[model samples]
Target: MGKYDLLAKDIIKKVGGKDNILSLVHCVTRLRFQLKDESLADDEALKQTEGIITVMRSSGQYQVVIGNHVPQVFADVCRIANISSEKEGGQKKMSFREKSLDLISGIMMPAIGILCACGMLKGLNSILSYLGLYSNEDGIYILLNAIGDSIFYFFPVVIGYNTAKKIEMNPFLGLIIGAALCYPTINGVDVPLFGHVINATYTSTLLPVILIVAIAKPLEKFFNRVIPDMVKTFITPMLVLLISVPLGYVVIGPLANMLSNGISQAVLSVYKISPIAAGFLVGGFWQVMIVFGVHIVLVVLCITNIISGTPDPILAFTTFVTFTTTGMVLAMWLKTKDKSLKQIALPAWISGFFGVTEPAIYGILLPRMKHFVISCLCGAVAGAATAALGLKYHTMAGMGLFEIPALLDPAQPGVSLVRAVIAAGISLVIGFVVSFITFKDEEPSQTKGEEIVSEKCKKEVIASPLSGKVKPLSQINDSAFSNETLGKGIAVTPSEGKVTAPFNGTVMMLFPTKHAIGFMSDQGCEVIIHIGMDTVRLDGKYFEAHVKEGDKVKKGDLLITFDIDAIEKEGYSLDTPVIVTNTNDYMDIIAMMESGSTVHCGDDLITIL
Candidate 1:
């Protein structure tokens, strides 16, 4: 295989060896994978792997950030994994909330590669200045700082481009809106909207541009519909440009700023009440805010305070969150047996230490959500301790480990420095110990086809609830069961009216309608025995519940008896689907009997391993 081809092979292996993948697609800087089970993919491993740029789980996609060569990598992934380039069964429609998340990630993620590079550059510059290797006045420092600040300064323009694509609006129009927001003449301009004076500062902001583009989509649509076909293209864009820029500044920009200001006041209030509690909250949820792209304004606020010689203590707490993230990754590195996970965890840990936590946050912690919570609690503890010890930053500085040096106060006589170190140690130890004790490697990916379950993995045998002929779930008439949206299992055309316990389980629920019975198998399976499709409409007619919910039942014991003839005559197909509701919990569930095979009560129906 070629270099890119080999890289794709490695990518597939790290993402649970291709079998776990449901579909794949690509955007500007990402290989978005829709996986069968997200937990099976080793995101951290993929992040540390060559040819991959950090990982992100947003909008129900396991996004592997690949750079400008993403299309080539995508082709390689498709070829290597033997999957189609186009996503199968078009991605499920997203909810408004999900669409919002998709918009934010799509916009923000495209810029993340440069953002990481810039952050690292800035951090490196900070390191050099602290070490006396470079001064802020040096040409090298000035040039490097400018390069590092490029994306942040022009962030609004980039966000506009992304928003346009998301909402299917004209791209350049979105770019113009963003450029107008960032224009030095327009930046920080004050305007009145809805009888209120508002500061329209759009530079390096997210909400204003996003809201502007969102409004522009419909406006573009309106112009496209009304404008004559002859000069429609130019006329629509001209009219949109004319209206959107002014509307953005007057309405969207100011409104976004007001909301941002309200949030800033709330954050400040929390700190004003109790610095310790504020520190704890900041340390714990700071990364979360960064994830949602909500930290830009707060960062601006803190930087403004620092520039005006006002101390901003709250942000200093966030530095410890990085340490805690580092600690958790270190624990994963030490504890995990998976060589791939161990490899990525170590690098992720190091990255987190340097205040570059995207590696740890996206690649590791977020996948294992519980470990993320542990990391947050550890950070909270460290933050509270840091505040109690009176550690605060008097100067604006780089993030992560670089912020430690800036936390020292000349007035505190070196004690603050010691406390900074102490707080870091506390966060590290807590994160490490807690994560190490609780951390477990992901359940190993199963072998191809029939799952080769481990010895300890007990198999659950579900007997046929009612005997007749077996049918593939997809062949069933009802979309809910046939589509497997409810769960995976086989449907049976019952020859008899009675339903029996498929396994040694309790009647978890006996629906009032008596159409379906939910069972909790002693083997920990949640099986639902629906007697007939849409038989619930019968409203207990021609259906009799033999056992009430919570009643224990042995195998072959009757649970429900329905008049099958009456139900069929009533236009309901008695295609009883014995569904394993918690299908995700097991490795693989397979039918013991072949489709169309005749079966009786106590016949082996499904086997879950």
Candidate 2:
């Protein structure tokens, strides 16, 4: 067995076993599962599991975050579960939004690495030319540019193959279909088909091939069902190609091309209205949109703009988000006294600098409320500057610093390169400086020696963190808390929005959403005080934290304050879960109060033994 076998098995069991998974796939760092019932998966157990970093339910998939080692872990997961690594049938019905996310994520995820590599190559080529190390006519320049441009030139084939596999069709057929569209003989040849002149090339096109392959699956199935087994193999493909290829050229291709053009024009029109506003809106909300999986919509827009031979300002504007996120992580690394947190933040910053911000967002920024806001605000300023200066990328590039190369305009090379560098510098400086200044380090009330002594002692009782009516953990709507996966806990429906320290303890973690806080009691009990159900969506709008991680506090000290009416109006439940994260370390955890009984802050709510 492999090293991750046990961890894989544990993950499978915790995700409601193999039966609950309809399809499974892994991207660079996440194990994306299309589960039978999303709610059945043990989110808390998976999060607390040894190998997993976290759990995210987004893009119509339950994503198990495993960081860089996910590919190997994914292999072990597939091996142990006896499941196919490739896309499979039996996808449960999904909403339109979910379906769109799944499709876009599937198509785009596989290409990101190569996209980054090519983008970097292109950028390096431009740098050499600008420095007079190599001219555009040089053999090295031609070879490198060809290498970088090959993917975009044949983008339809790549997209078609991936989209075909996602829709469970013959990927080879999809490739053939894409090739047919781009074939020299067919392209630019105005053939009179059904009174329409079919004279379009498919190279670098986005929508047509995907639409063609999507329709081809049902057609392929139809042909297979009617054709005899003896000749089905050849005949089915032949029929599919004959019908799909011509129909694609005559109708599907044209319609999709028009749609792509329309979308591109619409985005350009909007950007022209107020470039700064567009930049600010995109840069500020880009990360937030990513959290909700809505950012995939912009992927289509970017591709459409690139295919239409227009520079993609939408992508250009949003590039600041990664740098800003990186800045925040770096600031956290510098400001934090916790060695372990610094270790995590360092790598997350590096990842963000290279264009991948998931680590920084989830590992560092999301956990630090002020740092995240600072990053977003800085990103917005940089994005506005980038747009105002008319910065754009001719092709889709890897985000963050890696995308600098993509910003070089082949036609106006030096000017665009200079603009890109300026924008990037602005983004990096502002993101780092703003975050460094605004994000404060935690100040513990007790000395290190005192904290160590407190850790050695055992606390007999746990007090309520909020003045509210008490309820059983099982009664909470959230499965993670209700299942007691983190530990034995109690819930409170708060009448007041203030959360106080239930015991004299050091804060372990304070989530960036300002909705959750983790505390390690001086008496050695670890607790998590989550403010509300799904309040992470609010993005700290109605929430405020008074303490930072590592801060020590006394019982009844104000930890956080929130607006009850505001949060409720925003559609968030006020049922707070006060959990003992280290439940296994204790013999028993008993609730002192009954359900529906009102309790005051610092009142004995739980007893530990």
Candidate 3:
């Protein structure tokens, strides 16, 4: 068993066993579940469970809030629960916007790290060549450049494997799908399609592969459903390959070409109307175009412009976007309280300086969307500045930050290079300041949990479940409780061995061990009144539950009574936690009394806002 296997099994059981989970996917932190019934989930048990941060129910998803390591836990959950598309009745349905973003994220995220590394190398190589340390003709330079160039040139094949995994199709077929699209030049074939010619090359293009997979997913699903089991393995592959390949060439291939041409012409038309306006639009919407796989048309246009001896204004305008993303990532790094997000932000922004913003875009900016908007706004301003100042790319240059040298004449650098520098600087600053100030995280991104205050909500109080010395969660012995990973609220050292309903609520769970009780208020607050640390190991010794799961209880009603002295003598600390497991639902969870204050049963222990 893996390290997470035990946690995974326990989670599955607490979530009402394997049968309760309809499907599972993870995003950043939470293990998102489509449960057969949310009520069946032991929400308190999960909150009290080690490693889970908290639980959240939002938009029909029963989200088990694991912190940064959710992906690992998600894997283990899927494996142990025997969850898959077929078992879960297929993956959860998503809206068009959700599907599109998820698809882009899945395909691009896997390659981002390597792309960053290669881009940095390529940037360094450009620096070397510009400085006359090594020329492109050098054998060593050739090999290094080849390594750096391979992923971008053959990105479609890389995308193919990832897309298949995302859509639950065979990865090798995805590979073949990518390879077949790229290897055969459609322009060379002259294939006819409704009086339109399939006269385009798919090399280094993302459109054809993405379109092919989008089409192949349904076709493959259809074939799997209809094909006989006897010859399914051999026959399905044959049919999918035969059908998808031709469709990629005749139909999807033509569609990509048409889209590319239409986009390029539209951009050109805008550019002709006013270069400054075009620059602003490109700066703002270029990333959006990149998301849809149409930005390559502008890339092609830039190269064509350079070949024909006009400075590529399009490329110059687009350059500001890199710095904008980089600056926003820096803001994300500085502003986020999440250790994992901070860690992600560091490497991503560093890569941006070298001219690879893929990591930053996919990792930090795209997920939050506010960061993306800030970056785009910055980019639009810089793009407009570039055009307004007549700063265009003097020649075809290397990728990323290293291209700074290419825009300048080594012997006589002019105002053009200075203007370019100024534009980029303005974009970066705007991106950083705006993103840092405006963005809010999924959690409270600033301040440690110390004060128990907020006025955004009306006052609602949780009476002391046990009368004792009130303590902050930080003073608790258990890391899960101390860290507030299980959710927020204060702890209590019980002088009396009794737990009562803190509010009028149902007993959501009475752990079979009889040590911990989970309650949900009629007002919708979920609380866990854990009796003692590691007391569950005592096998219900010195513990008695007056209430069973699903019983409705009034405030001050006795729930569970434990022999606190016996549990303490047995080496378990009776630092019981009365946690608001759904702490995020409120503005603040306030501790009513200071730590070390003596409290009686039914005192206002917690003030929820």
Best by TM-score: 2
Show pairs that collide, candidate 1. Answer: 355-400
Q: Please report, in order, the local distance difference test score of every candidate based on alpha carbons.
A: 0.73, 0.81, 0.72
**Residue 280 C-alpha lDDT in model 1:** 85
TM-score of each: 0.59, 0.72, 0.50
lDDT at 415, model 3 = 51
Best by lDDT: 2
Q: Write the per-residue lDDT of candidate 3 for residues 359-444, one digit (tens) a residue.
A: 57655777777767777788898788777877665444545565564455323344545766887788788778877888766866
lDDT of 2 by residue, 255-345 (tens): 9988888878888899999999999988988888766656768866886677557888988888777777777778778887888788888
Q: List clash counts for every candidate, in order.
A: 1, 1, 1
TM-score-based ranking: 2, 1, 3
Candidate 1 lDDT, 43-157, residue by residue in tens? 5466668767577666667777665567788888888777765434334334676555555555554555455466556555665665678778899989987886666677778
Candidate 3 has a TM-score of: 0.50
Collision pairs in model 3:
355-400
